[model samples]
Target chain A: MSENMGNKVSLELYRTQLLARYFEQRASDLFLENLVKGTNHLALGQEAVAAGFGVAMNKSDYTYCTYRGHTHTLVRGAPVAPMLGELMGRECGILGGKGGSMHLTSVEHGAMGSYAIIGAQLCIALGSAWSAQYLGTDQVTTVFFGDGTTNIGTFHEALNMAAVWKLPVVFVCENNLYMEYTPIGKVTAVEHPGADRASAYGLDSIIVDGNDADAVYHAAQDAYARARAGDGPSLIECKTYRHQGHSRADPGKYRPKEEVEAWFARDPISMYRLRMMENGFTDEDLTEMETEIQNTIDEATEVAKLSPVPSLDIIDKDVWADGGSAWRN
Target chain B: MAQLTYREAVAEGIAQEMRRDNNVVFLGEDIAAAGGVFKATVGLFEEFGEKRVIDTPISENAILGAAMGAAMTGLKPIAEIMFSDFLAVCWDMVVNEIAKARYMTNGQVKVPLVIRTANGGGSRFGAQHSQSVENWAMAVPGIKVVAPSNPSDVKGLLAAAIRDPDPVLFFEHKSLYAMKGEVPNGEHVLELGKASVLRQGDDATIVALAAMVPRAVKAAEILATKGIEVTVVDVRSLVPLDTQTILAETVKTGRLFTVEENPRLCGWGSEISSIVTEECFYDLDAPVIRITTPHVPLPSSDNLEDATIPTVERIVETILKNMG
Candidate 1:
């Protein structure tokens, strides 16, 4: 279990976690300040999964996620500027400012796309995996979903098909212990859905401490290797938690204050940062990284603020690839 | 010139496109071994092999969803839905995802997928197996709905839809699959929005689509025998309707009849009537006529089902009445 033969993975984890933390904290502040409008699902406490898996993933590999995708986008190499511009509804955003926070994409970085609809990306990712295999490519796709999505029909169908076809996919379950407000225990009778069901499909699965960046990085490395080798799909259940409420508007009033405080106690970013220091990272070295990230985010925010908004004239465009024009009217 | 059945032409088109591009592949129920229930994809499995001509489980949603994903990732997929009526089960995959993904992504992604299915009422397959649902797809944005009535049109449009960079719902009428037509021997492709005039006349313009084209052709023959000339227009594609030709014909004839096998209310005929009325109101000499099935489920009995859908006799009688 302790594959910590070196400190390289731990350092990379610290880097990603740092990005996720600063990114979400800035987004949360902007949302509260009314600069960032619309629904914002901050991946505050769940930075470890995105950063850890992203660090463990190859450049050719792909990642698909649910509405909590800002962290995924940033970890997958999306520039902070265009992403911030997208969040601000600027034309230079990833989705051309059409899709806000919920629907963000940077296919060039191997992040196929993200969707707001729960469990929708599962089937889409499976299809992409199928394409990869059919085209005789070594690329693999990692599809991330919440514990709540495991109950959806698409989740079961996609998994079943992926298993039968042995698609080059790694299904990642970011079990943050809550789907909106409902707890995992309240919904699923099985303690670990990903691992338990993966065995039924004759595929390998594992449960890892999602907060432990090294653990996620190692597990993801295994899954990605198996998928790229055409050995079929693997499932990883990352038992993590979201530090903030599901969206920015809610205060998570349904859960007790102590529970939120309890999760906040095991903050993935702070834990990774401590690990970085323990591994001989100097205070000045950490400060330089922090300052660099801050300055980059500042420039991104400025670019997003100045980007033009898409006009309504072109709103009716791109409805169809050909000039057939389905939504012209 | 070569004579081929509609199903044969469709399979030929698939084979032709797959031969042209390595990125083109196909999948559907029994499409591999069984060669499809209608045999539209017959011999494709052997020719293309399992990786290209895949036989998927009886999950319509998975088949369509996987095809959409494949298309997005750089492959052109031709998916078979068996029958058009089963589209109801996979509506979410077709309408919500496949039809809207390109637009939703602001054209960043191109879902070059063709959903080929047997449509229209014939062979007494009843309401379940036999029903025209082209209108349902035409209502959705981001999708090109083309219903080919003849073997030549099938090959041309199927190739065109496969080559195009959009999600196309290509409906091959169940009755027309076996109907023979003269098709060119060499490669041929049809444009999506162009309508082909089957026959020319001066009294009235008879606009028809899919299976109704043959019926309207017969009606035009009858109208000619009675010295009442009727123009017949086959609308190859419904979504991007050939409004230019339709309006031109309607303006010259000053009378029109829209024929379809779907229900009369909110059918493609209704849309044609609305568009014609809006654009050619000044040239109208008589109210537009629509020949469609009754507002009821398709009957199981052959005679009963035939009575519901527009027929050659029914079309001829309607045309004569409009001539008044």
Candidate 2:
């Protein structure tokens, strides 16, 4: 299928992708230079996705994503300074420096949380969607997870429950084709992943070229609409790839060099940039956008670096909400 | 005040909270039409309907995860796990997700979910249905565990757990469902982490939990005839333990005995024993004795099952043995 689904692709969407790309790029530099001070998995090649679905939902709509969440959060309007500050373990971070890269959560931005436990984020997203319906709110929640999560028990449990209850949720499988350096083909039996599995739950599912921001936005819009209309849950599997390795430490040497090169050539950022140029955007216009994003990220990084590390006294705090605790000892 | 069974009290507790707070809802397998296998949720389905009293598919893990998710949002979800043995199947959801959310989020979110599960033996349902999971609940952090012995405590704690700003594990003994006691009419919300001293004595302090509370009470009656005075303390809440109440009683008595239905090794008694020993080490006149079942799975046979659970006879005998 062509990247465009007959709808006019917005330049604003392209700008969102650019912002996500720049954010991930800066994070990469920070992680590589050891300035971020934590292990992280950067969503390098997956810029279109982070921006596509991020901007597709309304402000009241919630999101639940995997550990590679900075790009998703940035595109969803989470403040860069606080997010980066969180990465640096500063008190000014989004979670007050408690949740680092893998566990970022923003209630203001409707980001429920990012989880390191494989399929947990997706499962929790169903709960939020159930809450929306239970409380008579039309707000929908989009659960983003790697295709690798589809094989897990939580995926089946969540999808089954969402289908039965008619939860306002859109399950987005960002199939990056790998699960921690292992090919999905080796680990998974199903070729279509979420698309194939969703049928078992009597859910409508679609496959999208995840590199195309317009395609994801359109798919997400349809799911969100059906959800808001009380039509129950659906699945959208986006075929994408992560540009970075599984984590900061690994070089992803297991992947064939040719495969990496092929994916690198079709980098979502460059493709979107090319599409913009063809659509009457100038080199100077692109440069201005890039420079502006760079400068903003630079200031954010500096602020994150300067922010004070979280106090150790708060280490024992927040265990319970009623000033009671289970882990005090 | 009205006399009601333990199951009736629990059902009333849920119903009263649902009436008071629109945010409170119920979800469990067969809890709607069947009124729960143990009938702990009887009449709630018709009173609350499908939205409030939801009958979920038989998925324990999903129930726990979804409840946490709902609690993090606006709804105060009371999820019924049916049996406490199934709790081990979804232990990750309890220990990892429910227990760690608020702390990991730096207090940004609170999971006010009440996980109600049938616990303990004596109904002859075999090992799976017969488990006292206070040890499991108390072992986890960021979770409040409540196992009320009588009808009154169940009613008050159920309402309290729904209103609590944290997650709670409400363990219900299978045998105690039909057990009757006087329950106060209308909004009765008990404070979590407060112990109820059922019987007052000065010779020794007996900290009893869940089903063991009633057993300890019976044991106190039996011990009184032998010229031995025993104080039976019902430890209503395990996680947010009322250490002050327990400590004061232990200091007054100078001898303490922890009673639970769980295994002796790494059970809730060990934690209580540690607390009393650490706090009242000098006040101790005798070695703190823990009365618990042997570390073994509950058997299916009537005679076998009887040998595993803590009983009044066992409590009385253990108290007598410890006194010397």
How well is each residue in A192-304 modelled by candidate 2, as lDDT tens digits?
88798878999766899899887888887888889999999988899888887889888898889998899998888788778777766778877887888788889988888
Per-residue lDDT of candidate 1, residues B132-243 (tens digit): 9999998887788999989999999999999988889999999887899999998988888789898999999999998999999998998899998989999989867788
lDDT of 1 by residue, A1-329 (tens): 13464666666677778877887887887777777789899888888899888988888777888789999988989888888877887787777767788877887888777777777788888788998998888889898999888887777778888988999998999988887887777888688867777777787768988888888888988888888877899888998888778898778778778877877777777777777778778778778888888887878788877889877765777777753355312
lDDT by candidate, in order shown: 0.85, 0.85
lDDT of 2 at A118: 84
Candidate 1: stretches off by over 4 Å: A1-5, A322-329
User: Each prediction's DockQ?
Assistant: 0.52, 0.61
Residue B234 of model 2 has an lDDT of 95
Error of 2 at A141 (Å): 0.4
lDDT for position A190 in model 1: 85
Query: How big is the positional error of residue A322 in model 2, measured in Å on the Cα after superposition?
Result: 3.7
Worst 10 residues of 1 chain A by lDDT: A320-329
Model 1 DockQ reads 0.52
Candidate 2 regions exceeding 4 Å error are A1-9, A323-329
Q: What are the clashing pairs of model 1?
A: none
